[model samples]
Target: MPISSPRPPPLLMNLSLRSADRVSYCADMASKLAMDKRLDDFVMILESNGSDLSVLVGLLDARMVSAGICGLICEGRVGEVVRVFRLVEGLGIGAFELCDELVKAVLGLELRRLVEEGELGEVEVEVEVRRVRERLKRQVVRSVEHGGVEPTAGFIRR
Candidate 1:
């Protein structure tokens, strides 16, 4: 018989220690969607995802896949979302940050939609959204500089 090595304790065990304060990311995202009516367009885009995700990804930009996930998470349908993060890990998309980017993209898309709909005055919306995006960029840069979180990767760049 071959000798087998003993395994270390599971990381999930460590995660369990924080279980009480562990908010479901999906639930938190859903709350944001509730507050942002503009996210409706992104929701519709996500609701359109069908059985073949790969095919859909090919037809649309790869970012749409992330958008779709945000849509599901925002809708509180966590069960329906694919666990792509697990597959992409080590290829370098930190799970936490992927969710962050997806949510950010959803918000961006919503803001754009609102401007197009004239719900927001075009010039005012453009300036405000640009400012908010710049602020978010600076915050992300600070997070990277502080090593607070790893920058995400593994996305198919368009």
Candidate 2:
């Protein structure tokens, strides 16, 4: 009897993605990169603090806290803003001071826009922006003082 040759290994098939699929894949990659860009900048900020921030960086990746902050800011939700500030504070960053400075920048831009359009007087815009900023600061301070934030599990090493 003639010896039978071993069955040939199955051929590996190449994925023949359609043009639509290729376009979708590219869009997905672009979105992911955009999200990562923010996190990369956040990491750099943390690293500048003159300590081994690798642990915080790793925790941030696990918790995606920055994404939550971005979402809250985009929605302009008042209540969630305190929680976002607390998250930053819990990570050993000075959230209150940073938020104070950021709010000024935001209001400055808004004030400039209002002046350009003649929608409101400079005094009115300044008063309103300052009022809102102070309220936000108080809320954030209360949250931090009261330990309102439930610590993220990423901070607790196994």
Clashes of each: 0, 0
Every model: Cα RMSD to truth: 16.3, 16.0
lDDT of each: 0.46, 0.46
Using all chains and alpha carbons, the TM-scores for the candidates as numbered come to 0.22, 0.24
Quote the RMSD, in angstroms, for model 1.
Answer: 16.3
In candidate 2, stretches whose alpha carbon ends up further than 4 angstroms from where it belongs are 1-51, 54-71, 96-104, 107-158
lDDT of 1 by residue, 48-155 (tens): 333432232233333434555666656644323322333334234343443447666555666566567875465455556756887878887888899886666332
The 10-residue segment of model 1 with minimum total lDDT is 19-28
User: What lDDT does candidate 1 reach at residue 137?
Assistant: 83
Kindly list the per-residue Cα lDDT of model 2 for residues 1-158, writing each as its tens digit. 99998865432121245534433443333234324534334434454433434333333332234343444445443233444344456567664333334444544555466578885464455556766887877776777678885444224566
Q: Point out where model 1 deviates above 4 Å.
A: 1-120, 153-158
TM-score for candidate 2: 0.24
